[model samples]
Target: MEKLNWIAVDWGTSHLRVWLMDDQSKVLQHLASDRGMSSLKPEEYEATLIEMVGDALPDQGSIPVICCGMAGSRQGWAEAPYGKAPCTPPSIDAATRVSTKVSRISVFILPGIKQLPAADVMRGEETQIAGFLAENSDFDGVICLPGTHCKWVHISAGEVVSFRTFMTGELFALICGSSVLRHSVDDEGWDAEAFDAAVSDAISRPAAIAGNLFSIRAESLLSGLSAAAARSRISGLLIGIELAAARPYWLGQDVVIVGESGIASAYEVGLIQQGAMARRVTAENMTLNGLRAAHAKMVEIAQ
Candidate 1:
């Protein structure tokens, strides 16, 4: 087995991912579990982490554990607190150390960034941005991270100058699963044409979204609209409204969508419709890179 030097963790509300790394920061092993911050208490965090990677720990010395995401939230292992925006992602100096009963590990949780004036906060996405800027140091534009809560961040001089969050993904879930449109949407087929038309409609008149959403169901029952088209349209309507609000961030700016999900692809399509060019990068790669960047900063601090 490759020698384990340290560990990297991404602990979110819904998932826990760990990477056993060598001295060179290469991943030696990858492990994950559904045990997340939402499920674990303060004391349980250490035990939960040990349960996930105890067997992989080195024998002679304590291994440094660098973590990002919700694990550092106020209710997480230990509150790493929020670093204000216009600053870089937290380095080792800003990390909150959680003393553990396990002598073999020293855990550090990196702080997330907060946009106070906008009342916006992000946990895991900050690290992704750090990792992104680590690679593309010259990049000066916006990064759109589409998920349950999408973030549109503006990067300037390698710092997160400002940002905005949109709950478009969460709204889609609630509307499609529990709202009157539930019957019109399904998990099958895709209609790019329908999606494009809905996006155009929503962009041109974002204020009509509520009425347009009901139209999906109305048209389905009256005109026999396909469930697939309805699903696509639901997604399009939500994203289109989001784009309308986030226009200042992406207008004539280089946009990069960091995610592997279908929603990421939808964002790319939505942006293209508005005459914006976008590049796609896998979320996992950006995350691991972010972890790697955090580790590098930690090393520099120790030296």
Candidate 2:
């Protein structure tokens, strides 16, 4: 096997994570930066990247860099294109890389995935899905990535056939932070009963959710529903709707929820209520693994 050192990056809207690997692809060191896509301009991207990886750069020709996440979006350093749905391992490998300079080092940005007219898009999660597939190559089913903007992906025969994006987390944040419900709820603490009740209400009468949202404030004014309870209600309602939308795809399929423990638990609860079997998998390192897989493929092609 040809020997090469690699730098892996998973840069998102609010944070940047970098990893250094030797020829065998074992991680040597990792670094993080707050200079994420949301805060940096195009011209400053190179300087920001070099600042994070400068000390780790190998003396050889530019270390091959593989990256995933919002770093490839329109607001990112370079506007890397999106790979449409029905993507397979080979199709992901066929994605074009974005080249940029960081002093003497060359950088390559991976393209995000998109399926148009449906208003669905993904940046960082695609790589994580790739990594998940790499490790569990035999599994074929539906993968649910829960986050600020959750993703529901269908994988079969080593390809991602179709996926959808849900704004569950974002909506939760909006309702909790800016809406009238904010005044009624506390951010800390989880109410299982309230959450379950809201999920049941939503699944049973999803159309009633919109009207009930106003009741959070109305009840607070009339019957005095606790602020925290109102907040949890809103969360349950949004997540419930997400589950309803995703039900069609997940029906009769094995479901894996890729996210941290807390969020995964919430999704699992919702899924269970809807008669779906769901499992939670840790995703902290999935992005790095996926980037490494992509970098390995690039090396093979170069050879």
Candidate 3:
């Protein structure tokens, strides 16, 4: 068996994923940990990383590590600078590295890209963009990455022109779990029709979203709308507002939604309502794939 050459890690705010890859770029083992950046102290990063990948590391004192996500943020172990937006794959590939305590390991921390005009910044999506580039080298269009802060990235000629971040998932969590709507909505299950209606209403009158959100409780209290449906309505309003903002960028371009099933569904519904043809792509291992791609590119450039 070939020896391991590098370790690819996607250490985000809430989860840590480590992959052991052989010289041929095949993953030998994949490990996950809940010790994400949000939960660990700055000093604990090294120990956590070592604990996750120490067993599979080689003794040559030369394993190149590549990582993305919040692990490179201001609160992360080491800060990775942000690359300005309107960047290409090569620009992203040219991201700088952050050093670690491990003498045998060299860590390359990818920089997040920001669009100054829009005040939008992303720490990890750049790596996923690299992964998308790796898979569809010739494609140029809009890619929607749905998550806690869903991002809509615009790519053309291999460059990320601009992107927007929507606080859809975070807002949903806050409203459903902590806000007044929590009492009206079910924690599980979705009402497709109500959700669709809310999306439509929000899209038609985007400015009214704020007022509409407050009305969720009122409708549930006075009009007898089910809590589940109200929850779905709030989700639609937030997602619809996002879609309304993102409509201009995706107006005539092909759209691809990357992320889990539920969020992808919401994005698809919103896009379809706005007359865009959006396709969903499961990004189950995109972080690992992205880290591997970054590592390989670094090795190529170094040679």
Clashes of 3: 2
- lDDT preference between candidates 1 and 3, better one: 1
Clash count in backbone of candidate 1:
0
List the candidates' TM-scores in order. 0.96, 0.90, 0.91
Q: Pick the candidate with the highest TM-score.
A: 1
Error of 1 at 270 (Å): 0.6
lDDT of model 1, residue 257: 96
Q: Clashing pairs in model 2?
A: 184-227, 185-227
Cα lDDT of model 3 by residue, 1-303, tens digit: 368888888888998888888887898887899999999887898889888777777777768778788888889978888888888643326555666677777777788887897698998888888787778888789999999999989898888888988888998898889988788888787888899999999988999987898888898889998876887898889888888888887799899888889888888988897889988777656666677677777768779
Candidate 2's displacement at residue 45, Å, is: 1.5
lDDT digits (tens) for residues 203-288 of candidate 2: 77889877979888899888988766787788888888888878887789999999978788989999988888888888767777
List clashing residue pairs in candidate 1: none
lDDT order, best first, reads: 1, 3, 2
Off by over 4 Å in 2: 1-4, 89-99, 116-119, 222-224
* Candidate 3, lDDT over the whole model: 0.82
Give, for candidate 3, the lowest lDDT window spanning 10 residues: 89-98
Better of 1 and 2 by lDDT: 1
